[model samples]
Target: MSAASEAETRFEREDTRRRWLLSTPALLIILVAAVGPLLVVLLYSFLAPGSYGDVRWQFSSDAWFNVFLERDIFDDTLAPAWAHLSIFWRSMKLAFITTLLTLVFGFPTAYFIATRDERTREIWLFLITIPFWTNLLIRTFALQEVIRQEGLLNTLLLKLGLISQPIPMLFTDFAIGLGMTYVYLPLMVLPLYASMERIDFRIVEAGYDLYASRFGVLRRIIVPLVKPGIIAGSILVFIPSLGAYVTPRVLGGGKSMMLGNLIELQFGQGRNWPLGAALSIALMAIVMIALLFYVRNASRGGPTHG
Candidate 1:
């Protein structure tokens, strides 16, 4: 090789090494701070449960086996863990419903904010984020107050002569879904607003100019353009909704148990650390699958901005 070529290669290698050295602290933090707990949980999931609340040192896949199947203590017959499956299904169903609800509400809210003049837009965005100022638990309790049988909605309806009595709303799947949508709505709105803010409105105008109906313009010109945001918002809302504990706990009143509550039950009252760890891992796997789906869609969607 020529001297110049050799010199350039040597400089590039040094630069790469320097970059790695600079990034070492962040890499180490991620490995130790983040991966350390996960590694512990992974190790715990493979161990036998203690007689009481913790894990034993002995290796066993019984915890994993118990996740999907339960061996009958009497006949040694294996059966599907119907209870666990139900909890898993409920969690996924609630998460999916929450994502859909947030999208339905947030898309218009985002578009509204995006369409506003700059000063007014800032005010609306600020209002959307005001919920973040309160603690999640506090917000959940407020929602609980609103939806509980004797609460605001029923009271107002009763006063307005719209109801014969207080409607039962709390301690149900409906309450759980409502709480999750309320909690995660901002997450959905922000991403959508970001995407919509970058859109070229002239295309929308052109669609209308071409005699496209409002629905047609929205379907063809707007939604396709905000596909990436929609995907991102769904992921943000869905993954967290899957593991949501506080809202479901408060709203469902323990009757409508979710996967998060089930996991907590194993760890806390049930005294099965191995099972809890297994469940934690299962939840992470679901999250990873959602992330992968998002990546696939995002790559396909590409940039939608003008």
Candidate 2:
């Protein structure tokens, strides 16, 4: 080969090597931080419990079997296992509601932002993101205070003679769902914005030129184009909402317990590590199955944004 060609080839090889070397640390960190913990958890899920609530090295499927078979764990007046199942279903419903509410509130706002002037879009986007600057727990607590009987909302309504008594807003499923939607709305918006921003204005204009109604264009073109964003945002909101402990714990009171709370109980007051590990694994399995179903549907739906 000519000297110039040989030099270019050597440079490209060295560049590839340098890039790989640069990426190695991040890859290692991800493996150590994420994969390592998952591996430990998976191992723990298969082991038996020992004295003092330790995991014994003996391999056992008792915990897994109980979870999979939905066998009752506690033989009380209110079966603890049934209670846990009820909590799981309730959490799932709340998560689904939160996801739907976020989508309803976020999609139109994102679409408007995406279609607006750059400066106006930035301002609206900034407004949407402002809430994220504060701690999520603080935001949830703020909502809790606002919804309390003597809090700002009820006080204002009472002064206006809107009601005779302060509404029992706090420690209800409605409050918990509202808290979840408030927290997760931004997550839904950003993805929808990203997806909508990529849509070609030309295609939309073409639809208009072909005498398609605005509603038709939106329903046919925009919605299909934004399906991936919808899926992503739904998954983002739903999964976290499912595993959420604080919002339900605080807003739903003791009555709004979820799988996350159940897991926490196992590790805390319950002192049943094996059972906790089993529950954790079960939760993970459910999430994975749901994610797979989402992926399958999204794939069948045609082209995705990402």
Candidate 3:
């Protein structure tokens, strides 16, 4: 309306345009690198496989159908792919267990760190993150050495006369679970601590002053306040655990297979690129569903933890 108001509006529009221009490079990179490849994969999922490493451009529903059952391409006879479905279910189960284990261990660790003085908290946080300094493969190998029958744990137990023979620890589901927890515990703790750190101590004190029990206060006030972090950390741990290859391979002795291993098999030995692409797309769909749920939950939770 006024000349000065019009000038302010123009300035704001110019600032917005400048911000978009500045972000264009990142947008272009995402389009070309990530989205472009994803589109190619999606296209491949709908097509048939070539004899070698290439894909046939002919449209087919075989890849999608193959996800849950095996079918003869010529005769059209279908059989249940119980093995494939079971692998997916097993991956989900393992991921859920890993998330629960991490939450159980990490909550107290995070709370302790959150309650500490600033310097002490920094030291504890640094200690938690020390594992990241080493290569993951090297760390996994170290774990393998420790858990192997003739390795450190068994040897120490033997010297102490705790057992006549080394206990079977490697190549079991338990070993894979342990590996997942060890790797992903930091991911859980960091988010929980971040959420816990922002909680108002005065509210906690008020709860105590009102004669609320510790558990009561924690459940009613603290837990609600930090629900976002719990969800965020769960997503971080669970999704990665579902797709875990190294832990299942090395620790589970390659006998216990998960979705990641299945996907790798399709691409590597099986040489079925279309099926691999379909599997990848399925994994992506699962992740997107989790994210959508997260977004809906965050919106309902409001600004405090959202």
Report the number of the highest-lDDT candidate. Answer: 1
For model 1, the superposed segments whose C-alpha errors exceed 4 Å read: 1-25, 304-306
Model 1 collision count = 0
TM-score of 3: 0.94
lDDT of 1: 0.93
Candidates in order, TM-scores: namely: 0.93, 0.87, 0.94
Candidate 2 segments whose C-alpha is farther than 4 A from its true place: 1-15, 70-81, 297-306
Error of 3 at 253 (Å): 0.8
Q: Is candidate 2 or candidate 3 better by TM-score?
A: 3
Residues 69-146, candidate 1: write the lDDT tens digits: 998999999999999999999899989999999999999999999998999999999999999999999999999999
TM-score of 1: 0.93
For candidate 2, lDDT tens digit of each residue in 151-261?
999999999999989999999878887888888999999999988889877899998988889998988888888988889888888888889988888888868678899
What does the lDDT come to for candidate 3? 0.90
True lDDT of residue 85, candidate 3: 88
- Winner by TM-score between candidate 2 and candidate 1: 1
